[model samples]
Target: MSVTETVGQTPLEAASPFEMRVDLGKDVPETDVRSALKSGEIGFLHSFTTGSAVDGPGIRLVAWTTSCMFRCQYCHNPDTWTLSNGIPVPIEKAKEELRKYAPGLKAMHGGFTLSGGEPLMQSRFAVRLFAAAKEMGIHTAIETNGYYGDKLTDDELAYIDLVILDMKAFDPVQHKRVTGMDNAPVIEFCERLAHLKRPMWFRYVLVPGLTDVPEEMDRVAKFAASLGVVEKAEILPFHQMGRYKWERLGLDYKLAATTPPSNELVAEAVAIFRNAGLVAD
Candidate 1:
């Protein structure tokens, strides 16, 4: 399917070639990744990391895939949102690099994490990659905004050991205004994942006057509670780390002049979600 067609469509009918998994024979072993890497057959390009301290439980081999559906004003890696960006490398290459970090990751009881640009946007590739990792006995996690859950099947969900969900905003109108997308699908995705009993970490970026509002926190807390599987709800204070990227990319930095929320404001927002019974960390 065309890129435009798949951009905002429901997951069940996803037809983007970039997001679909390409089978390379059932018996292909992880050892073959080296050759695949050398030949440049990776379906979606990835930014590989040997050890990432913040992504999950332990030091992790994080694969930051390129491609996202949202256009959030405060997004850090604005370059990752477009489909045509990033260098292509074979999936094998990614696996091989991750394998090298396996021992260290294991020591931390951490394995691998698949992060953006909206890793779920390329769920097909993610599914195959995670399956291959599992075959190698690696634990897996996905850090997403829950934007593509409709396209994700139970089989796909089963492969993921953990999910870090970003709840951008609680007010649908404000959410769309900030992210250029509706909040319903993201909200519904969380509910569905919760029903599946998936382990989840819900994140909310405390965007000063934009997202740290008490009412908004209550709404998000209400929605998160409905999911029940939320292990923790995090309030991430907004920062200007990506402001330069926006300027360099020739994109308007809409939130450039906005200041981050004060520590007291962040604390208040955290308390709101905390009161809802979600472990606010």
Candidate 2:
């Protein structure tokens, strides 16, 4: 099948900076966006959550889009890692789902969140989705690995309300080894994202000896604090809830021997980032 058929829509016109830049590499030009949207060339998304309290500040409508370019060892959603794993529901349908919880969202002052195996992996879809959400006055957020930030246009940056950047590891070599990619893009993405002056949440998975090293945590903390855009620094205690996915998929459970960090350990990591002048949540 063609890429368009796979995704189910031709994207809307490249009306904003984000759209034009994101689609710059394509054969289609920005001038053709309106026609494309009218022609239904841009396919809408599949599904989304109506109410999620954990992803952002208030209750949130989350769109967990399928597809990812990375293969992290401890990923909780290995099932969501593939582009073709889930049913395609369309973006309008997704919005309809979010509306069901609109009353709750207004009560909690919450909005919409887009997350995935790597949302950036589906940047085109994300750009389209964000545009749609923004038109509806929904406060939009993204939970991403920061790998695709640089590749986007400035206009795209304007649509997002918040960005929660996940730092896989402070050490580049370890990060590449663990996540099957280098850390340079992730780091560069963060720095460029800072220029947008959007609220950012830097999250790290405290993987015992692997990611909890005092020196490394300090380095990460310092880097994040230096960014000046971080609204919150969160230390996510590593867990094995997804280990079973790896087992079921017949993939190697490299971190299988690893245990979750103690609350004290988590606290210590939190302190390091906090001490560096970043808020820890």
Candidate 3:
């Protein structure tokens, strides 16, 4: 399908190359996330965790919201893809949850990170959550795919201390193949964040035979270099750790035989970005 056709269709309606395990019977209404900001209400949440270091600098209280537009084949959190799967947590209640970790987070020089399935899907909730965290003297960050970067207003972006932007693919066709969506929005989001001078960490998953191509890696590295605000580039080695989730969800496991990239390949990919003048690992 063309990018325009895919853009207009919801995940359920799109002709995904992979077997998707979405419930067509369940009608999840499109949430007016902006209205939630005005009402000071809760948002759909998958869960939250305390003391995660890999998510951001120091320990972090990472809140994973529900719903996502992409059906990434290598996604580890397939269960988080549906809105109906998550519980609703009030904005104030979410704040209280963050408060429990605030002291610890502050002492450790850590912060709160709003994460997937896609935090931007619940933009208002994230804004409110970040605002509350800042008010409590806690730093705030977000791990986003950048597809919906425009959702957050300048005021909302002000509350975020860092942005971990996941750039899936440098090639448009490959991007659409890996994620059942176009790369235009993601690239545009990166540009928007750059224009705003947002501190960012670029993340890319290295799937051995899929995204480890030298030419594409070079393009990705060049793009990252162009983003003057990028402080770090993380080359995440893809693994089968999330394969069980796909099986549990009854979705086709396309990469069941796929292996993580070799150490040499990882180093090579890292070097591509590092050579571009960015701190890569």
Candidate 4:
């Protein structure tokens, strides 16, 4: 279909990543979707939000991909858990969309960031899109869980300008508790980037009563400190903005009444990273 048909007259524009977007690719056959994922010619995007400064350096245009293996209890966009929920867009189309903002993005020192339910789930699409963005002279970043960090070849990884790794937890048990996944590959990815001297920004989500453990965060902070490539460490306080999505989708909303982390909590987390000699905010 066309962009107009997929979502309005232009590319899908979401007010924010928290906006509920679903069934954009519901009509595609399973076989075709699988083929596209393997080829990277087309990507399944949940939505693309423009003018985002929180995702990366300066103002950014961030694309949110669909599908993820982790079922983090604090996850806000539960709608992205299924790949088929995304809108199907060809690689060239995505490039065209990026091309439109390339000039302004460069002028503003901003670029493109492909975030996700877990972007590496659509590894090929993300790599190809990053390459396209690079060719356009636009900086590229990925906000990822680092679970599928191996999906990008070293050469492919070079296409990316920065990696905003959302390293949830360091301890395997806590990692599993937070994101329902292994932490080994995530750490390995961080180490690999350090070895390559690739620039990185580490982010940890501070959830009340769940991931607020000082010892656990200190471990993560120290690990990020050891990486040497982490230029910025951001402690993203967990918010309930996505709680409505779960309620609407009829999914079990565990953190139904969970509030955002207090300011003191945020400051303490930042201090932990700062104490490790890393620039933090």
Best by lDDT: 4
> Cα lDDT of model 4 overall?
0.89
Worst 10 residues of 4 by lDDT: 2-11
Cα lDDT, model 4, residue 68: 94
**Candidate 4: residue 56 lDDT (0-100):** 92
Candidate with best TM-score: 4
- Estimate the overall C-alpha local distance difference test score of candidate 2: 0.70
lDDT of 3 by residue, 63-111 (tens): 8777889988889888778865655556777888888889999999999
When summed lDDT is taken over every stretch of 10 residues in candidate 3, the lowest stretch is 10-19
Cα-based RMSD of the predictions, in order? 9.6, 8.0, 8.3, 1.6
1-281: candidate 4 lDDT, tens digit per residue: 55337654334767888888888887777788888889998888888888998999999999999999998999989999999788888888788889999999999999999999899999999989999998899999999888899999999999988999988889999989878788899888989999999999998889999999999989988999898899989999999889899899998877887889999999998999999999999
lDDT of 1 by residue, 154-188 (tens): 88888889899988887889899879999888878
lDDT of 1: 0.72
> What are the per-model numbers of colliding residue pairs?
5, 14, 0, 0
Badly placed stretches (over 4 Å) of model 2 are 1-47
Candidate achieving higher lDDT, 1 or 4: 4
lDDT of each candidate versus the true structure: 0.72, 0.70, 0.80, 0.89
* Model 2 Cα lDDT, one tens digit per residue, 155-183: 88888999998888768888886688988
| Model 4: CA > 4 A from native | 1-11
TM-scores for every candidate against the unseen true structure: 0.83, 0.81, 0.87, 0.96
